[model samples]
Target: MRLKISLKGAVQGVGFRPFVFRLATELGLKGWVINDSSGVEIEVEGEEKALQKFLLRLNAEKPPLAHIYSQDVEYLMDVGYATFEIRESRGEGRKEVLVLPDIATCEECLRELFDPKDRRYLYPFINCTNCGPRFTIIEKLPYDRPHTTMKTFEMCPICKEEYKNPANRRFHAQPNACPVCGPWVSLYTSEGILKADRDKALKLVAKALKDGLIVAVKGIGGFHLMCDATNEEAVRLLRERKRRSEKPFAVMFRDLEQVSVYAEPTELERALLLSPERPIVLVRKRRDLASSVAPGLKRIGAFLPYSPLHHIILRSVDFPVVATSGNLSDEPIVKDNAEAIQKLSSFAHMILLHNRDIKRRCDDSVVKVIGGVPVPIRRSRGYAPMPAKLPFKLSRKVLALGGMLKNTFAIGFEDTVIISQHIGDVENLETLRSFEEMVFDLMELYEFEPELVVCDLHPRYETTRWGEVFAQSRGIPLIKLQHHYTHILSCMAERGLKERVLGVAWDGTGYGEDGTLWGGEFMVCDYRGYDRVFYIKPFRLIGGERAVKEPRRVALSLLFEMYGKSASDLNNETVRSFTQDELKNLYIAWSKGINSPYSSSVGRLFDAVASLIGIRQKLSYEGQGAMILEDLYDPLVKDHYAFALEDKHIDWRPMFYELLEDREKEKVPSRFINTLAKMCLEVVLRIGVEKVCLSGGVMQNDPLVSKIREFLEKENFKVYTHQKVPPNDGGLSLGQAVYASL
Candidate 1:
């Protein structure tokens, strides 16, 4: 009997071909197996019983790293093949294979890395078919070595032998290399002068970090600015050099045990830290080390070593190290050696250089456990480039340009949508150019071009303008989606829902359908359309965009709306911080709405409460105010503040009046978050919907979402929160792409 089989999904770059070759050869089957753009294809002829067993175990005994989304078998006439061979990959196909994200070093490779008898021992680039750079090193499809950055170096005789052996772990590994032929790391001064190379260089890096000096170490995706995490001076110096204040930094530990010493990780969080995709898990802080690590927040971003170099450096030091992206503030991570030297030298005392070329720049992913489930905050690095399977097939290729803040783009075709890794804010030309290049890079990799383009409705967004220009240049149809609606759609897309859902979309700001800023929103929506049912009462951003950075201004605007000019007499920190004359000028701006814009943003409400409670007055990051407000939550206090629900508006004026007069300020954050959650439930009850979707940036708040889920689930409503993509603007493009597909 003869049969041909086709396997789709993450079948490439995961030893699928070798696994097939070994299985066929062991079963005395003849023919060949090869990788193509579409996925893995195999042909084999053997006894009927053997073939049946092969079919059964094909998926059961496949490689651990491989995922089979769909598999098809076709009967074929016997070709009288005598031997089984692993044939060369084919470049021609529809390119339906899912591209995998870069993975962490496997246990087998880690065992070999430290074994002195092993030939590749102490090799920083040690990787097998199960691990190493995938999305970042591969320049094209077919998952062959020639298509990867490793093509620059030819394999030596010893390594070449391993590549041909089907039983070997390194068989057909795209990045298979050793000290003799693979890429090597070198240590250089900030001036770009080389000092040491290979193992000695890594040892020196450990010493530098131990001595409280900052070193930029190149990793799988990009360079990470690293310093001793326990050294307060080093942490302070990093904050000073990067001009980054208040925002937290991710720390890298040697292993999970080391991570447990600093932060408390749940069982699921531990699994996430130890998963193949080793993302930074936001765990609750336990023992205190450095004051400036996370500053005001109770949680710390902690992750284990993902690469052999990380393993070696971390194993050398007793303390953990701060490993944040090596880039200027509000820019993409630095990938190139020359680029790192030029932009990162101002902050890093030393730079670690490597010859491996990174085809894409991906930052570390961040995940937090909310409601006993892992929710993505920033989806990049180990979690990106892996596509989402759409519920429905699309008519044509679609391009989705995400919002201006936390920008990411998406490409959709057939039933697949690939969301680009986080591309930072498209605020400056440099970031905008990076965003454009990455957008095209993914398209080129998939061999796809858009027939239609979708973008946010905001006209001022660079992504919107870019999408318009691209659409015009290609003569493609273009569509614009409301920002908050796109957020709900992203969550809907994750669940592959087709029916109507009550969406609770709350964020800091987004361009609304009515030309005003919308954040706190309630809509009965489906894929086809939506009806806006309720929204938070509108308030003003006192100084336009400037109010985003100053929580005090947001509080002033909310106060003015509630009490007019006499509101300045309140005894809150925000009111008392300003003099009578300064308050008078601000009141004039707020009352007359000089440069202020009316917004119904729930994120600003969090900021206002933070300012009123004297917790946070300014923000250095996008979610600083909300995060701190979440930190202040007292779950012991179960009561909620009052709010007046008008016909279509959820007025917060009564809540503020109660907050201003209440002397129990410690319980305000809890009551505030509880009230917002209650308001959503109130609106949902009024709408009379069975299924609900919670999305938007404000939904990233753990305490807030937890309470909302508790309230809704108690009513037996099917509440759906983000499980795959993020709830913030980072996930906007995925929503837009899925919307276009429907």
Candidate 2:
């Protein structure tokens, strides 16, 4: 009997080919197994019973990361092959090959770490085919050891044997290494390079934690700010040092069992915890952990230690650790040692250094529970560079600038669209540099020189600037797509929707095609074209740039729109923040239409509502006002705050007046947010869009997301949201990448 099999999903990086080679040889089967662009293909010749047994074992047992989505087996009558041979890979276009992110250390490596008899015991870098770095270390395609960062470090005699042995787990493992030949960890205290041993280094880190000192530790992908999770004082001290207020910190647990005390884990969550992709999972808090760990938050973000280094650190520490990006607020993760020393010095007293060179910086991914499933908040680190299959293929290679905030870059070659790890806001120079470096690195790795580039139409966006520069330098044709159109395209790509869609692009703000700020918009769109079907009534941005940071300015904009005169003319000093002259200039700008672009942005509306209800006057972060505003209402129970919907437009003036009425009465609750969410969702449903695609940075608001999704379901309309990618700009590259393909 001769059998032909096709295997799919995450077979690349993992030792699937070699595993098959050994398995076929062991079973005395005759045939060949080769890797194609689509997936691994195998043909085996053997006795009928033996072949059946091999198929059963293959399905029952597979490499950790290799997910066999489907296995199609066909019996062949012809047997032209001799003994089973491991054939070379077939690299072709239009084939679906799984691209996996760099994985954490696996259990086999962990066992060797603690084994005193093993040469790799206590080694910081111990990896085999089962686990270790993949995407981060690869310098070129075909994913062989010679084409990776590991090429610089030659394998020892023992390692060489393991690499060549078909039966060994380390066979063809691109990043296979031990402490003897791999990266090493060092302790840097105030004196620098402390003479302490590895164990003492761990102890010193623990002592620093006990003393309420922050430590910056470098991980496989990037640096992390760490402190004792059980100590409220330590957590609070670190929070103050990092300037993070109220945003929840991700806690790294030693194991799944340790997490149960704080939050319950479902079977899917348990499997995700144990899976190679050790992403941070958000779960409801049990009220035992200190509130300071997640200030003003009901739920907690938790993750199990994915690497051996994390496990070793957890062993020395007493509680769940607060591990966050090692950067000042809104900046990219610090990758270089010198940058970590300079930027993190203010907050960190000591640094656990690593000799491994991190060519790129990837922030820890954040995930949250929504509709009884994990939705990625920030997509990076554990899951990136993996190509999401597109329904249509591109005509030429292209590069895309995602968005400004939570920025990420994307590269597309043939059928594969590779999105870079989370790049921070492009507003900062450091983040911009990281984005450029990663883009260069990925292009070189894939041997792709983009023939085209794409960016948002926004002229002020740093992403647009970078894209313009790169396109000019490389002489690549550039495509400037509408921001909201790209947002709709993203939803379309995710759902594999190739035809026209009722595109609902509601966000904080986007540069409209007609030289205006557009956010809340409904479009009838397809891959080639789209038209703005409906939009919210436009209003002035009172202080322009100042309005984004100060929600009070937006409140004044709404007030002036409702009242005949500017809010500043009312003699309220609070309103006097904008002088009568300043108010006159603003009104002139609105009247003459100099810089004021009419926007129906739902995000700015949320900000205005938040400030009107006194939820937040000054926003410390981008979505702070909207998040706090959403927190004020519960959609579970009935609430009566209603907004008049006229045709396809939402009349926000009534809601503004209602807020003024409530302010005069001095009453507010979470129901206000719930009412607005219900009203907005109701209007969307009334427009008769069968599928409501929720997007934008504002969609990061969980409370509003919950209310809207529930209400849309009740209205018998299908609601779609970003799950494989983030709802924020961190996921913008994916949309941009797909759009470039189109």
Candidate 3:
């Protein structure tokens, strides 16, 4: 008997063909396996029992990196005369093969890097079929070396032999190379002066970091601005140079044990840190290193080295290192070596660069353990270009332009929605160019031409304007989706929920259907549409966009709502932070509605409380005030303030009054957060929806999200939160794509 099988979904660049060939040979089958534009294709001729065993093990014992979405098998007449073999990949087909995200250095490669006896010992670019740069190096489809950065580097005779041997780990590995022929590292001064080459370059770079000098190190995804994490002056200098005042920099530890010494990681967080994806895990800070590294935050983002070069650098240095994305604030990460030299030279003392080029710029992914599960905060690097399977198929390809902050776009065709890696904020020209470039690259790679474009309804959003222009240029329909509605749909799409769900969408700001800004909302919705059933009482954002940067403005607005102009004279800490003229101007703005936009955002509410409690008066970044508020939360306090619902609108003024009264007695931010959770429960209970979906940027608050989930589950309401995609705007594109398909 002969069998032909087609396997799809994340089966490319993951050693799938090698696994198939190995399985066929073990079963004593005679045929071949090949990779085409669609996916992996295999044909085997063998005994009935052997074929059965082969099929069972193919699914059961396949490569750890391979993710088979669907499989089809057909019987054929025996025509094979030769033994099983791995064939050359074919490129002609409708390209549907999922591109594997960049995988971290596997254990096998790490062993070889440390072992002096190994031929590839101390090789900074050591990689095999199971691990190495994939999505970042590939330029186009079929994932061949000719279409990658590795095309310039010719493999040595030893590597060529390994590439030919199916039993070898480097079999058909596109980036396979040895120290003799592969790319090498070089160290240069900030002014482009060469200092050292190869292994000596790495050693010098490590020494520079130890001496409190910042270095720009090239990795699989992009360049990372690195400095010793323990060096307070170095961290402070990096922060000053990057202009990232309070945002926590992700630290790279040598291994799990080293990470454990600084941050308290649970089993799930430890696994995420060590996973092939190698995302930065947010964990409780166990020890204090540099006060400037994280500032007011109680949790630190930490991860182990993902590449051989990173491992080598960490090994050379005893302490953890601050490995931040190599870019200025709100700009795209630096990918090109020359680009890094041009942009980072002013800040970094040295440049540790490699010859391998990065085709796509991917930032480090961020995950936090929420509700005992690792939830993605920013999905990039080792988890991009991999499609998120849709519950329903689409007849036409669709494009989704994500939100303004933490932007990520999506392209959907048939049953798959491929989300772009993190595109950063689309507010500036550099990030906007990155957004357009990645959109074109993904479409070109997937051969997708969208029939429709979907984007947030905010008319002023740069992304929305781009979508409008794109749709108009292509003569396609543009679908304007409400921002919070998409947040709900994004969570629902990931969970495969088609029915109407009670959605609690809480974020900083989004354009509402009525033209006001919305962030806190309770809606009954599905993919097709949503009904805004309830929301928090609308509040004015004094000074409009300025209110976002200065939470004192938001606090003043909340106070005005409660006590009118007299509110500014409350003699609170927030009031003291502002000058008399500023306070008077804020009051006039609230009273006269000058540059004041009305918003019902739960995120703004948190910011207001943060300001009221004197935790943070201004934000250096979006959600900074809220993050500080969460850090100040008193875990022992379980009490909540009072709130009232009027005509389905939640009035938090009562809660604010109670908070003000309690402020004199105790400064507990947790009580305010708990009251918000209680208020959500109150709304859900009133709405009488059994299925609830919680989403939005505010959902990134682990303690608040956990509290809401716990309260809802106790009421027997089936609560669903984002797990596969982020609950923030980073996952908004998936929701837009899924909603457009429906």
Candidate 4:
């Protein structure tokens, strides 16, 4: 029997070709395997029994790194081929190959990295087919070395032999290189004066870290500005330079044990840290090694070294490093050496440069364990380019531009949607340029010419406007997605939920259909459309967008709604956040609705509660107040506050009154979360949707989400939360794409 098989998935950059070659030889099959835009195609002739075994073990005993998402086999007449061979990849086709995400340094590579006798020992660029850079280094489709950033580096003799050997692990590894031929690292002064190169560069970086000097070190995806995590002065200096004041910096530990000593990680968190993805995992802070690292927060973002370069650096350092993106606050991470020297030198005393060019700018991915369930917060780095295999195939090629904050645009064709890596907020020109570059990069990679473009309904959003121009210029249909609805749909799309679901979309701000900010939303929705069935009672953002920075304004607005003029008279922490004059002017503004946009956002409610309770009255970063409150959650406090759910409206006035009467501010976090859970139960029961989807930025709140999931699941409601994608605006692109397809 002869079989012509077509396989599609994360099979290209991975050791799939080599695995197939070896498999065919072992089966005594006469065949050839070749790569294509859609993935691998193979033709094999063998005995019927051997052919059956080949099919079984093809996936069963396939390469550990390879994933076969879809495989199609056709019986063929024997061509009398004498030998099995690996042929050159084919590029002419509808490109559907799943671009593999960058993998962290595997245990085997790490072992070889430190081994003194190994040829690649102490080599910073050590990698095999099982691990190292992928999506970050690739330039185009077929995922061949010639089509990657590694194309310039001619392979050394030993590496060429290893790369061509089907039996070797480095076989067909796109980024495969030895120290003699691969990219080399260099240490430079802020003025671009070269101080050292290669191993010496890493050693100098380690020394700089130990000596409390910040060093901008290049890594797999992009540069990471690192400092000793235990050094308060170093961390403080980094914070000052990066202008990232309150947002917690992700700490890179030497190993799992060191991470355990700093942050309390559950078993699953430990697994995530050790996983090939190597995402920064948010876990409880067991010991505040550097008090300034995560001020006031009980949890910290922690991760292990993902690359051999990072491993070598960590081995040399006495203390774990504070690793944050190599960019100023809110800007895209610096990628190229010139960009690092130009922009990053302002933040670092020394720059650890590398010759390898990053084809895409990807920030570190983030995940947090909520009630023992790992929820991806930011999907980037080792988690991007590898798309979500859609439950339903699209009729036409589509583009979905995500919302403003934590922006990520996506492209969809067939049954797959490849959401771009975290593009950061697209408000600024640099980040917007990054977004634009990535959009075209994906389009060019897939030969995609979208039949439709999808964006949020917010008219003022940069991405929405960009999408509008793109659609108009290309003469394609444009579809605007609702912000919160897509948050729900993102989760639904990821979960393959096409049925009507009670979507609980709670975020800080999203443009409502009525032209107001809608954050706290409950919609009965599916892929096609949504009905705003129930929502939190509208409240004024007294200073408009300014309310987002100052939670006190939101609290003030809520108080004024309940107590009228007497809200100013109530002498408390929240009221005292403003002087009598400021209070009076803000109240007047609230009363007149001057520059005060109304919002039904649960995110604002969290901020209001955070301000009212004095946990945090102002924020330096998005979700700072709520994140602080998450730490204050007392599981011992089983009690909850009071609220009114009446006629498609959630009235928090009752809860505020109860909250004000209660003096135990510590109980506020858990109680408020419980109340929200009960509120969700009330609405879901009323709306009568058995399947519930939790989404939006507020869904990132561990305490609140855990409570909601717990309460809903106990009622036998099939509650769904984001697993493959984030619930925040970062994951909204997936939903927009899903909506476009439906």
Model 2 residue 441 distance off true place after TM-score fit, in angstroms: 1.3
Residue lDDT tens for model 1, 27-102: 8889899889989988999898988988998989999888888889998788899899988889997878888899
Which candidate ranks first by lDDT, i.e. highest?
Answer: 1
Off by over 4 Å in 2: 1-9, 32-61, 67-82, 85-99, 111-121, 152-161, 179-181, 236-248, 260-275, 288-292, 413-415, 566-597, 663-670, 676-686, 740-742
Candidate 3's TM-score reads 0.99
* lDDT of candidate 3 over 1-742, digit per residue (tens): 9988999888877777888888888778999888889888888898989988888999999888899988999988999658888787788889898899999999999999999999888899999889999999998878888889899999989999998888898888899987999999999999998999998998899899889999999998899999999999999999989999888999999999998899899888888988999999898899987888888888999988999999999999899999999999888999998998899998899998899888999999999877677789999988997778987897678999999999999998888899999888899888889999999999999888899899999998899999999999999999999999999999999999888899999999999888899988999997778899999999999888999888888888999998987887888877888888888988888888899989999989888888888777889888898888787777677889899999968998998898888844344578888898898888899999899998999999877988888888999999998888899999999999988456
| Count of backbone clashes, every candidate in sequence | 0, 3, 0, 2
Q: What's the CA error at residue 738 for candidate 3, in Å?
A: 0.9
lDDT of each: 0.90, 0.74, 0.89, 0.89
Clashing pairs in 3: none
Candidate 4 per-residue lDDT over residues 611-642, each given as its tens digit: 98887788999888888878888877887888
Instruction: Give the clash total for candidate 3.
Output: 0
TM-score of each: 0.99, 0.87, 0.99, 0.99
| Lowest-sum lDDT 10-residue window in model 3 | 660-669
